[model samples]
Target: MTGQEAEELLREGALTVEGRIPDASNAVLYCSVSHQERSAHCVYKPVEGERPLWDFPDGNLARREVAAYEVSRATGWGLVPPTVLRDGPLGEGMVQLWIEPGHHSDQDDEGDGALLALVEDEEPGPGWKAVGFAQVGPGRTALLVHADDQRLRRLAVLDAVINNGDRKGGHLLTAPQSRLYAIDHGVSFHTENKLRTLLWGWAGEELPEEAVRVLRHLERDLSGDGELAVRLAELLTAPEVDAVRARVAELLRSGRHPVPSGDWPAVPWPPI
Candidate 1:
């Protein structure tokens, strides 16, 4: 379905809580949403149910989720699923269309094998770059893995621009036709330098030509009176939106993947 259609359904649909996502830090409900003839399975995070963080202000996570979608669209990558801010059964919140994984063709069989195998190994093989190690046992038993997909590389750039602070492994969803979707962006767009992610595999590498082109387009769009800048102002603080513009400019100047900062944790906990 088109993004506009999906967004409309998300905005207007009647939501019924189906279940809760186990082990999620905050309350996340799996909901069945229906709007007239259109029906969709979605995830809803009510603002009233959020677990407050020390850094982020209270009750703004839902807006941040929607703002992340706006940045995704402005970048022209469509990396984030269609998301909208609306009132749900619980309260005001963010609603996003659910994407199911493992619906690929034979062409993706090889890549799937690589991904599954890498998850179990202690080191990444060729065509992959190890980002961090995950402790699976008590004594130095860490599992090493990497993300080798080009789409994820693009998403890394997106996370950088948005200052995403909690890009956990489970937030990356796989959809049909080998498409990857980034979710759980409630902690994004902070004015502080808080880009925690596991997508540092391409650090120090030159940005691909396609990424450069998209960054240039986004930089232009975020300029004064542009659609992206205007939309962001409605969802984020002035300083937060300005920080996004600054990130874009810095990315364009560097023309390469950003190195990890020593001040913050480069990888999120429970690296997928």
Candidate 2:
């Protein structure tokens, strides 16, 4: 669906709470969203239901979620699911299209196996990068891997540009056609250096040509009077928006995947 259609549905849809997603840090609900005749399965996180975080401002997570989608769309990567901020049964919140795993295509039969293998460390062979080792069972050590998909690599670049602070393995979702979607972006776009992710495989490597092209476009879009800058101003502080512009500029200048700065934890806790 087009981003505009998704946004309209999320804004005008009737949301019915199906249930709570167990173990979610915040009160995330499984919901069915309908607008007119169109309906979509969605995940909703109400602002009131958000757990207080020492770092992020209260009542702002929902906006941040929408901001992430905007940035993803601005980059033309479509890394994030369609998301919108609106009032829900629990009050104002963020609603995002739910992506189901195991969706397949005629061209790729691997389905969600590649993603699962990355998380489960079940012989995620070539085209995957092992970031660290995990204890899977008694006396058994398993490798923690990330898919080497170009789309995911672009997402890694996007994460750096946004200063994503929580990019755990669980946040990566596999959609149909083997597309990877990044979620739970409420802790992103901090002015400070707060990037934490599982995609360090391409560190210090030159960004692929397509990624560089996207960054160049993003740099232009973050400048004055650009659509991205205007939209971000509504969701983020002026200084935060400037920081995003700075990040885009930095990426365009560096032309390579960034290495960890060593100030903060390089990876989020509980990688998966």
Candidate 3:
């Protein structure tokens, strides 16, 4: 389905909870949303079910999730799934179109081996970029690596722009057609520098030409009185929204991907 149609179903459809997603920190409900004859699977995250984070404000993660979708939409990369914020069976929450696994699940090593790997060798080899060294077992260390694929590179840029704090490996989803989708964006759009991800392979590298062009467009769209700027003001705090613009400007000025600030851990825990 098209993004617009999926969004419409997510926003206006009747959501029937199918089950709960296991092992998630917050409540993640697997459901099917239907509007008349059209129906699709979706994930719902209610605001009331959110766990308190010392760093982020309470009860706003749902909005942030929607906000992330907005920014993703603006980028024209469609890196994030079609998402919306509306009332759900639990309460007000973030609803997103469910992405069916393509040939592999998120942790399917057989398929995603090229996208991410723990290499015995020190270097990442050709077509791969080293994230950093990781401790795999007792006294055994391996180099954490990710593919140099353009899709992940674009997502890395999006992560930087949103100040994404938790870009875990499990958060990366592959759709039926091999489309890449990044979910769990509740910790994004922070006023502070909170970018954390495994896709740091391109750190300090020059921005791709396409990414530069997209950033330029974002810089314009996020400026004063712009549609995106106005929309974000509703979903995030004024300072947080301003910080997004600042981040875009910084990316444009540097013309290179961002490096970790070293104030916090560069990669999320359980980096797989």
Candidate 4:
């Protein structure tokens, strides 16, 4: 469903704005929760629309993002906060746990150092502010100052198997604590061109011990008899999951987790 639909469906106490809807976010919104749940400082995102150059259908990316996030979370990436595809005052909008440092939470311990490093990233260039946590690599002249080089690399390997395409820099978020979190899974899963990302350098390299642990866990869940695969089957097609498995098998076959070569579509265009 579209963001507006989300607004309308779950609009019990959802907030809205007169005209201050963010660019591209078609609807204006605010927090609807009464209790001190995850959305303590919730800010609503109305589905304005997508910009040019993507050519995707309306709200397709957002909807898929929520679904993929479910898959990712079930696979052991607790980075994403719980989200709901609910009906809001405007329409069907996806409400998620806000990431901002809030009253109950100080900062994610793992997030602080990482964010400090990103803010102090003069080694690459100026204005490379750590926007989000996905894959923020350097351009032809820029240095990829994304925090924890290996961490993102490992996630990318897992992402390839899952066929996550929109793991760009903006999709990754960093709280003041340095803990890295990924967002926006609307473009995940195996599609014709669902590999848009930045962390492709360690393609053939060994998946780290920490990462391997997570992979092993996910592998078990995707054992064709497990629930995650079954859930994906309901949300996605068998061929899509098969393609992802094929990519995973290829990565496992080759020992090298090589990095990116700055290729087309492999690295997101415009480098945002």
The sequence of per-residue lDDT tens digits that candidate 1 reaches over residues 234-254 is 999999999999999989899
Model 1: how far residue 124 lies from native, Å: 3.5
Model 2 TM-score, 2 decimals: 0.90
In the range 1-272, model 2's lDDT, one tens digit per residue, is: 77788878888999999999999889999999999988888999999888889988888988888999999999888989999888999998999998774442111235425543435545557777666677778998877776677876888899998899988877876665557688899999899999998888788889899988998888888888999989999999999999999988888788888889999998889876
Q: How well does each candidate superpose onto the true structure, as a TM-score? A: 0.91, 0.90, 0.96, 0.64
Off by over 4 Å in 3: 102-113
Q: Residue 107 of model 2: what lDDT?
A: 18
TM-score of candidate 1 on Cα atoms, chains taken together: 0.91
Report the Cα lDDT for candidate 1.
0.83
Alpha-carbon shift of residue 189 in model 4 (angstroms): 1.7
RMSD of 2: 3.2
Compared with the true structure, the alpha-carbon lDDT of candidate 4 equals: 0.51
Largest TM-score belongs to which candidate? 3
Using lDDT as the measure, which candidate wins? 3
List, residue by residue over 1-272, the lDDT tens digit for candidate 4.
33333323333444443343343324434464532221133334434443322644555444454556555576565556555565545556555555553211112345333322233333434322232233345632324544335446555665666666666555565554444566656556645536666555455557676665655666666677777667666555677666655655555555445344344356565444
Off by over 4 Å in 2: 102-109, 116-125, 135-142
